[model samples]
Target chain A: MDKKKNISMAVIKRLPKYQRYLREMLNNDIDRISSKELSEKIGFTASQIRQDLNCFGDFGQQGYGYNVADLYKEICNILGLTKQYKTIIIGAGNIGQAIANYTNFQKMNFDLVGIFDTNPKLCGLKINDIEIRDIDLLGEFLKENNVDIAIICVPSRSAQGICDMVVKGGIKGIWNFAPIDLSIPKEVIVENVHLSESLLTLSCLMNGAI
Target chain B: MDKKKNISMAVIKRLPKYQRYLREMLNNDIDRISSKELSEKIGFTASQIRQDLNCFGDFGQQGYGYNVADLYKEICNILGLTKQYKTIIIGAGNIGQAIANYTNFQKMNFDLVGIFDTNPKLCGLKINDIEIRDIDLLGEFLKENNVDIAIICVPSRSAQGICDMVVKGGIKGIWNFAPIDLSIPKEVIVENVHLSESLLTLSCLMNGAI
Candidate 1:
């Protein structure tokens, strides 16, 4: 963990987008790509691409460009996606089921190992071979299964409580889909996916003079 | 439209967070608030808050602080949430359904008017009193109804096609939840919500020294 090498979390968030573009380029047999080319394809500026990639290390030649395969591997290692992560999604509702059924997460090194919900009617139900377990078993199951990440798909009111339980159950990373923000310990990391904010952004763009 | 304002979309995205806090203060009957106090509560610096708000107008006093109600109403107006916007969601899947069922959108002056899905099996389905109609009806629906915002919640493979159709159907604003980024015309506004990017950010926060 090189503190000096700490990239902006904002930049890190776009690694997957870069990865997706690189994958497509690779599939299309594109061996090398310039910052300008990548930027044009990805809707970012050429300088932004260079600045973000330079944070890790020099992966590009002076006049030439970045080797598609090499840059892909470097980004993968930097994003901690070189290996699969054991993940569990809590709340077997619509959003939770979507996570369970999502195929892209499989490509991105997240393995949905289990799902938990307090709804008795939903317990024992299976979505694509993954059974929905009772929330009562979350603590023991997380410990036993050594789950590293837990995605909270519960309602806003239940988010903080579930986050506390997940952290206490030894899961430090959480991807929250709830509208409310959670206050976790310094050791725990919570990322909020506020759908409303995204909608509001679209609304502004619609209403703006642009 | 205040072209001089030129606030970054990122800063605009955080206005809702500030509004949320201001609403809390109003609920608690806190009549006045300084930039420092608001910053401390929201994890932003006082200068950042001042700058973000200053893009709209100066509501702060020299010695005292901002009037809570006045600032709140000003921020709301700046966000264009003073007028209600009719939003229709396409693809009645888990994420779409979740957006329909979400209560905060209505609270934020967005009305979830309609839901569309191409799946014949899901036609005429209802979520939270809103009916899910056939995708073929989107054009007439948009013309008939007052829907100004269209949310694309379909699969990644189908997202681009739906976006094209929606744009042709007279939708100027799109909130795309699919993983892939669509190339929309300059006349149309498209905001993407990538779940994988959010997950990767959480992973980095958990693993990196930051």
Candidate 2:
């Protein structure tokens, strides 16, 4: 656990993919897998997997591979999935509503505690049993709820402002779906789901421009 | 244009961001910007910006800086935005419906032509005026239409099958929302929006595990 703080961003990014594959393996009753086999399945090099896993602690034995269930649990712990996260969506727009309707995040322990939108028509509606409140009440709601993450699905122009509010309300993480980048304090972690950028990347690749 | 074919993936990823910032500048009535000024706005080093732009062609003057509109147009061309793409969603689930409702993609010229779902209840329902079609009819519909992109929003178990069908139907690009890595032919381009992995990334960062 002490070694986790120094783990590289590349390894950090790969952890979720590892977690995913491991979870699937667990579901399929795959009890153990050698590094090479796991690598073949994940498309990562065996040495790379060993090195990444080593950053945290020893897992796999020399001849005996890793135990799938054990690795999945450890990866989940590393991903902070051992504890439930209380989250709120700051926009009740298309993306926000969809996220609110998504049961997968809830299954992964991300609880949607509230939803907020500036539009009056959207304010009173409920999605996944969570009501969409007026944006004006967002600050107060944040103060009342122990929200660990804020899902910003609002328009780009309003994203930064919403981000500021969430940060002020003590949000530690932000899942931003907006196009614009939000400037926040050093402690706040941001994960962007930039749809337009992703689409452009596909188009650029399809165009054979890279 | 030939140089674009050899551009690195790192630079290709950065092009969308440059396009976005330039478009914002254009919206603000900013006609031109020096690399230094752009670097300050975009958070990239001026030298990096100059180098990335130099991949396609010479656009910025030695002293006068880059013309915003012209640079935006060039970047769009490089991103294949000069031509419109017909897109279809292969699942009418939460994410699929949200993408269909998103008008921004249409503004960017990714026209959502059809939506498909295995669920009988979802079929024939309309989203953004495009009626959702039965999955059974997807193959025939693809043959009849010129679809440039297939947005896969199905569950992991069904993703690969849907991918195979779309590839057979001649899709050049895939925007996958499922949490599975798709196997595709070399000519096909795939861009994934793995929300679960992204959320885990945020949690890991917030957990200080990396």
Candidate whose DockQ is highest: 2
Candidate 2 structure quality by residue, lDDT tens digits, B1-210: 567677888888899999999999999999999999999999999999999999888998999999999999989988999889999999998899999999989999999999999999988889989999999999999999999999999999999999999999999999999999999998899999999999999998888655
TM-score of each: 0.92, 0.96
Give the Å error, residue B197, model 1.
Answer: 1.4
Q: Compare the candidates by lDDT and give the number of the best one.
A: 2
Per-residue alpha-carbon lDDT of model 1 for A90-120, expressed as tens digits? 9888788887887778777788899999999
Q: What TM-score does chain A reach in every model?
A: 0.93, 0.97
User: What is the DockQ of the complex in model 1?
Assistant: 0.53
A89-167, model 2: which lDDT tens digit per residue? 9888889988999899999999999999999988788998888899899889888889999999999989998999999
> What is the CAPRI rating of model 1's predicted complex?
medium
Q: Roughly what TM-score does model 1 have, to 2 decimal places?
A: 0.92
